[model samples]
Target: MINQTGKFIVIEGLEGAGKSSAIALVNDLIEQHTGQAPVCTREPGGTPLAEKIRDLVKIADASDPLSDEAECLLIYAARTQLISNVIKPALAKGQWVLGDRHNLSSLAYQGGGRGLMPLVKAVSDACLAGFTPDLTLYLDIDPKLGLTRAKSRGQLDRIEQQAIDFFERARQTYLQLAQQDDSIIVIDASQSLELVHQAIRSQLLHRLPLLFANK
Candidate 1:
């Protein structure tokens, strides 16, 4: 059922998998196809308040451990604001929503990478409350290469600076979810940008034909 609302698409990947760029490309493609600019935004900063929370969470020197549970809650908090302020309103107005990151990040980062699998269900169940993406693009990449690219970009955030093992687990977990979930499409971001964009466009066209079709 096309529930009288717009579809929500989330772009997910490790730090340097080009999620931001892919999101911009996807947003543009959606607009070009649908003739309406989707509500494009990122997590932990979609809303002004949430952006503050993001800064705190990303601070490497913060005394707080930012426990997996806390991290999950903080992400949910940002998501709540994002849903209320951006997502729901856009969907109600029949505008597509393209999010750069979503709960999947916490799932892979905390549950898989940080070895907090047990906390996954609790936080996800209580916090998410059935709000799931219609489609998730997981840009898969090697952690070593991804981190190197990330380093070149600039200084790393707390999570961005995590050890190679951490990101390896994160990437693995994302791939695992892609295997298990039909909604997730895994793309090899190790390829060149042009190839990656082509793959993503193809996948989006195949999965969201209605959105891309003649209106």
Candidate 2:
């Protein structure tokens, strides 16, 4: 339902929520339907400076630990860089942008998990008051199962190494936000990958029929 020629689509979820596969599916669908490959981007990355910021955010250092507020600021700093340098340009060029993670991740992780919603909100408002994704696919999953799956992937990052309770709060916040916003579609990630893809496709076709109507 977005009026812009280029749309911003974001995928959000906790670690091991199968976001990688979801991104692939979304990319394929966008290309197939539009005959144009969407520009893919990931928050805290996509640009050189942003990638460096991503490393800083992910790596754990006992000697110089990152405080909750500092972590939140770092995430926004990286996001601002990505948006200014990559996302905005691609969108202005009439290219659909598929984002691996967007602002929602911060709202969940920094706000809910870290219990710093007020500061997160202030930063978000200052940086991106009017910006929003055209569509957000949120893969919902149990934190314990998500952590187990994440662990199976190899070494965990600093945020991923957090206790289960942290992810639980994040999940709760995701659900609450999804309930309030029609633009966000929640998918049960516990199901098979095929089922999750089906849900995503179904939601896309139903919610944004105009995008694929001619195709």
Candidate 3:
């Protein structure tokens, strides 16, 4: 049964689309209203074991012998752990949980971006067993601009260093997913950080007026 007092909000987007920053802003907003800090986390890591998998994926060198299928499966394994250990328990306790990335990241990044849709869906369906987020905030940004910001940063991780074309494909896939799901809100992230935060706030309020109104 769904909990009456909590909400699950997932923030998704390309690498440089400002997902981390937006999550901070939204958490603050939610706490202001709800009087409790939301549970914030990210995947491929939410538990101790899941975090190990995250490190393997992010820091693995090209010379490592991990196959595409293996990589995808590991991600799902971590996701399964995350849901069992963190998300479900938080909701059971009536605490909102805001995730930096969720299952959609796999659908867009590995499936759409890397052409592994079948693999992504199979793992998601088998392990997830039909769990879904209440709302997904897709921070949309052009690949060129997003990559520019990413490159300006220090050493790039495995997914971060993927070809620019990969991100383009990922962004397009995100849009397609958003179109199909009314719960997904795509916010143009090319604007200033403040503006983007405002947009997120407005969108969240519009979607869950009762929750925001009572807070």
Candidate 4:
């Protein structure tokens, strides 16, 4: 077996941007090189306590609708739980972390969509102790088409049922952040599934030296 080296790879996108498909591709490549599946985690959930926090944020109760500020606080609380309980320990053990989403989601959704960038950034600064993904694969897609795809799968969740403009704003934030960060790579998720996978493969080939450095 190859030597165990830790790395954190995150898959990010608006809903229906094919994040799951992208995650599978990245997971496969890492497994092929390491001979083991990476430790998989999803934001807003991952640990038991975090999962409860996820439900609190993702479910809508009109009788007691959540304020945007409270939602942001709750998300960070859950994120801290996952990061401290799951992600950090795994990395310390030299295991890769294949995360479904991470702090970027809050930056885009709460900060951009909900127009709480200042609050989100402040909370992020407080909770995040300089942890960041080694690489982020951002699958960019049109929110209109992405919503259609998300709807086809099943009923929309609380967040999924947000106004189209909300997703549009979030998309813009994701693109903006990608532009500013070299560690974040943008993939045209609007393409066919195979094409999306091909793009991910090419990027991994170029940037993922850890997997092959010892080969």
Candidate 5:
């Protein structure tokens, strides 16, 4: 049976961290064990308005550059829209919520990478209040390797196009935050896909036993 309180699980990582595959694994596991599919959502998206904001945040224009503060606000704006319209509503109905790159993405990219922690923190405080994920799986990988993988996919977006040093800083921040938060589990994303998937499954099963009570 579904639990009385819905759980929010977020997958966080830098570019090319295999978040899509991780999300798929989590969703499949939840359905297999709980017999209920989670409501999947992605940051800077999952809503019409949020999607438009995503476009604005991604499309690069060298001549008309976006300031760090502006970028930070845009991200939070998109997040607020998604949370208010989709995430919260789905959870209220006792449905699990699976997120691909939530608040942590902003903390890593905009705050750590772009050096806008104060602005990001202010926006997060004002917008999200104390909202947090029940379980966060952070995929850790070397910035260079991750960037190479991302490049193989296609042209990098504005954020993805950042320098390797930027991503390294982001990775460090992710690691630090993971250590501080017991709910955040760090996974070695450099491993083989199967191994990574297995690790994710193991962590989920360990952290959220209630979801797999029937299994």
Candidate 6:
């Protein structure tokens, strides 16, 4: 049931909000509806150049640390490559793009965490030209609990190594933006895995019913 047009859906959350599982859940539903797999992407690294930037973002040098402004620029650079070379083309060709994360991450992480909303928004507007997802599922979780969960996986990345206050600030930004935008929906990720999945499913059914109508 591949439609003539494609939709872009993004999943947003801090570390350890179970984004990977949530992505799998949504991807399965979309595949079932379209009878094909959507093009899956992750921010900061969907393309070859983007992938390199993603590594750089995660493992910064302690010698001359990346400035907040510099980090924002690098992210947008990666995003530009992803959008110009990957995401936009996929959408234009009537292929659904399922993104692991998107601009929202920047707003939350860089804008809120680093107190650079003005700079991040400016860069976003210049780079995206108002392009955005059809639907965004935000998995909300407590930063402390989320980081604890993240810790079990392995060593934290440079971004993940931020202080508790930084993540709290980011979470607040995520909530504020979600409240302002109808396209963004917040799901309580603090719930059990099954419950989280259930909420995500219900949201898809409510927000994008057509995708599930035939299937």
In candidate 3, clashing pairs total 0
Kindly list the per-residue Cα lDDT of model 1 for residues 1-215, writing each as its tens digit.
23235878899998889987898889887777667778887887788988988876788655656775777678778878888888888977878899988888878988899888778767778877888888899999999888888999999988887788998888888988889998899999999999999999998878777543423
Q: What is the C-alpha RMSD of each candidate to the true structure, in Å?
A: 2.9, 2.6, 2.9, 1.8, 2.1, 2.1
Q: Tens digit of lDDT per residue, candidate 5, span 31-138?
A: 776578989999888899999999989999889998888888998999999999999998898788999988988888888998988888889999999999888999
Q: Write the per-residue lDDT of candidate 4 for residues 13-81, one digit (tens) a residue.
A: 999999887888899988887788999999889999999999999999999999999999999999999
TM-score of each: 0.92, 0.95, 0.93, 0.96, 0.95, 0.96
Q: Candidate 1, which ten residues in sequence have the lowest lDDT sum? A: 206-215
Steric clash pairs (candidate 3) = none
Residue 126 miss distance in model 1 (angstroms): 0.9
Looking at model 5, report the run of 10 residues with the lowest lDDT sum. 206-215
Model 6 lDDT, residue 159, Cα? 91
Model 6 alpha-carbon miss at residue 108, Å? 0.8
Error of 2 at 146 (Å): 0.6
Give one digit per residue, the lDDT tens place, for model 3 in 80-197.
Answer: 9999999999988989999989999999988998899998998899999999988899999999898887778777787887788988888889999999998899999999998999
TM-score of 5: 0.95
How much is the lDDT of residue 63 in candidate 4? 98
Cα-based lDDT at residue 43, candidate 5? 86
lDDT of 1 at 141: 92
Please report the TM-score between candidate 4 and the true structure: 0.96
Q: How high is the lDDT of residue 28 in model 3? A: 85
Clash counts per candidate, in order, are 0, 0, 0, 0, 0, 0
Candidate 2 per-residue C-alpha lDDT over 8-83 given as tens digits, one digit per residue, 9 for 90 to 100:
8999999999999999999988877667888999977889998998898999999999888888998899999989
- Which parts of model 1 are misplaced by more than 4 Å? 1-4, 62-65, 210-215
